[model samples]
Each structure stands twice: as structure tokens, then as C-alpha cells.
Target: MQSSSSYPEAVEQLIAGFRRLPGVGARTAERLALAVLRWTPEELHDFGLLLATLPERVGECRVCGNLAEDDLCPVCRDPARDQSIICVVENADQVPVIERSGGHRGLYHVLGGRIVPLDGIGPEDLRIGELRARLDSGEVRELVLATGSDIEGEATATYLARELRRPGLAITRIATGIPVGADLAFADSATLATALNSRRPVG
Candidate 1:
């Protein structure tokens, strides 16, 4: 059978590449390919080099599980940040969302994902062990649970709140701003800020 596309093989290949990325549909992929085609050879070379080196340059933060170029993430290296409080989030993506809000000056811990029983993911599948190790160091006084408002997120938060209870630790949950069933990855900075600022003690 003959192929359906009329475009050159290279252009089709570029569009396919863009389509592999999350949320890039056929139209968007075409637009991206066209845009890339307009770039100078030197610009294209630079872009290719960046993509080639991305894997070597980026790795998970040793302390917080956020993406990092070195052994620790930028937040872990900053001594000025509040060391006594740690905001726990569901994923590294949510770290930036909360950061953009300019709320919660404390450091963060990325759980990697929430607990979903139906999906067969439990607390053991996440970074809960690493979190426990951090808490054991005796520096953190408060833990701000910033997981999503969804069911799985709620289960994970509740699990952590129950498991991590101990002397002098004040565990708090983000308050009313984020709507139920909403993912922190898609939440606006303003809403995140409100949620963080209004955090209440978790029972």
C-alpha cells in the first residue's frame, strides 16, 4: 500500500518527533516542525546538542528528588531557605508550581507520586522512606503536605500524616484554594499561593 502523506520524508519525521511529546497533537506537531525548519543550521545544531546532553546534565536531586544538574537540587544548596519546614509534594513538577506561587519559603520533598490502591501503588512505591530519613535528622519541625486534591493524593497525604507523627513535628495540609480532584501540576500560581498560605494542621 502507498503512504498517505505528501510532505517530504524529513518533514514527516520531524512532525512525528514533535508528536511524541506530551499534548502535542498533529496540528501542533506540524507547527513545531515548520518552526524548526525556519531555524538556522547553527541554531538547529545548538538545539540538537542541548537535547543530546540533557540526559547527562539532569538527574534527580539526592535530597529532595527534584531534577538537578549536580548531586543536590538548587533548593537543597540554598542555605538561606528555612530548614525547619519541608513542603511535601506529589511530584517534581509540583515543586515548580509551588515555587512560582512564592509561598512556602521552606524546602521540599517530591514523593514521585501518590498512593493509589486500584493502580497498585502504595506508600512503599514512593519516596516515603527517603522522607522518613530526612525527618529522622531532627531538623524539620513542620511538614506541609501539598499533594493534589484528588483521591489518590488525599490517601497519600493521610498516610503520611498518620505514619510520620512524632514529637515536635507539626504536620499541616494545604487549605481550601485548590479544588477537589485538581492536579497541582495544572494549578495556577495564585491558587497555590493561597493554599500554601492557608494551610491547616492535619489531624
Candidate 2:
């Protein structure tokens, strides 16, 4: 995409950077760049600084692998949360959806991503080791697999169920037929609540 006459080389570079974002095409990138160019110098500078510092300022929780500003995320550190029951999710973003359903009071373990062989993601690449360590501690009584109902999500859940089965621990997968191929984060509260209530034991 050629730059407009009004846009300088530096502005074009910024637009190209924005274009690298997911679902952003050249036209959308130009729009975003123009919007930023319209901002006050102070606002633009602050926004740039925030973006620059994000990588260093945020990290995964040591225990649950969720995005965290500190050593552990709020859910992992909260005393009110039930530690005996753990909800295993594909990513941190899905956490709020389960919380909103008001059906789960347990802590969470973010797998970072599912096992998608086509994408070259494997079980070892995720946080499955940490989950096993948590279960080995014998404190957890139940594991609710909240991965999506898509092909990759199903594969991930099946792998986890086989890997995490133990004498004292009960493993279950969330009920499907809610929104196949969609993420748990996008499911409505009622659907998510029903799925949670109808979770089935997974061997």
C-alpha cells in the first residue's frame, strides 16, 4: 500500500506497524494511524509510553499461568476462592466469563493455549506441567476442563483428562451443545451456567 501524500515516511511506518495486528488491513491501519495523529501530543506520547512498557510490566501468574501484574493473579491469591476445585481454561480472557456465570467459585489454571498440532502447539508447550504439580499436591479435589468445544479444544481436554486422572482427584469436562467452535469468553451467562451445571465426568 502506497502512503498518501499528506502522510510522511514516519507516519507510514506507524501505519504499517498497526497493519501487523490481527484482522487489521491496510485501510484500517491508515485509519488508526490518522486517529493517533489527531490526538494531542501529550496523549500520543503517553499512549506510546504505555505500549512500550506493557511487555515488562505484565507477566503470567507463577501458579495459574494467567496474565498477572504481580507474582500471582488475583484469583490465585484470593483466600475466598476455593482452591480444592480448579477450572482449566485455554486462556486468561475466559476467566471473567466463568466468574460471571456465578456457577464456579474455584480457582483457575490458564493453559496459555490448546494443543493444536496444525499450529505446532503441543501439550509440552502449554502449562500442563504446572497443572500436574498442582494436582500432585493433593489439595485439589476436582478439575473442571473449561476448554472450548472446538476440535483443538476437545483434543486438549482429552489429553488433560488422561494425564490428570488420579485416585483422589475427580476430572470433568464442561457440557457441550452450547456454542460449538466458539470460545467460552463469548458464551452468554445463561449458556455458560447451564454448561457448568451439566459438566460430565471425564476419564
Across 26-141, the per-residue lDDT of candidate 1 in tens digits comes to 88888899999999999999999999999999999999999999999999999999999999987787777788899989999989888988989888999999999999999999
Cα shift from native, residue 176, model 2 (Å): 0.4
Candidate 2 wrongly placed segments (more than 4 Å): 2-5, 23-27, 117-121, 178-182
| Residue-wise C-alpha lDDT for candidate 2, range 133-174, written one tens digit per residue | 999898999999999898888988999999889998999999
Assess every candidate by TM-score: 0.93, 0.84
lDDT of 1: 0.88
RMSD each, Å:
2.3, 2.6
Which candidate comes out best when scored by TM-score?
1
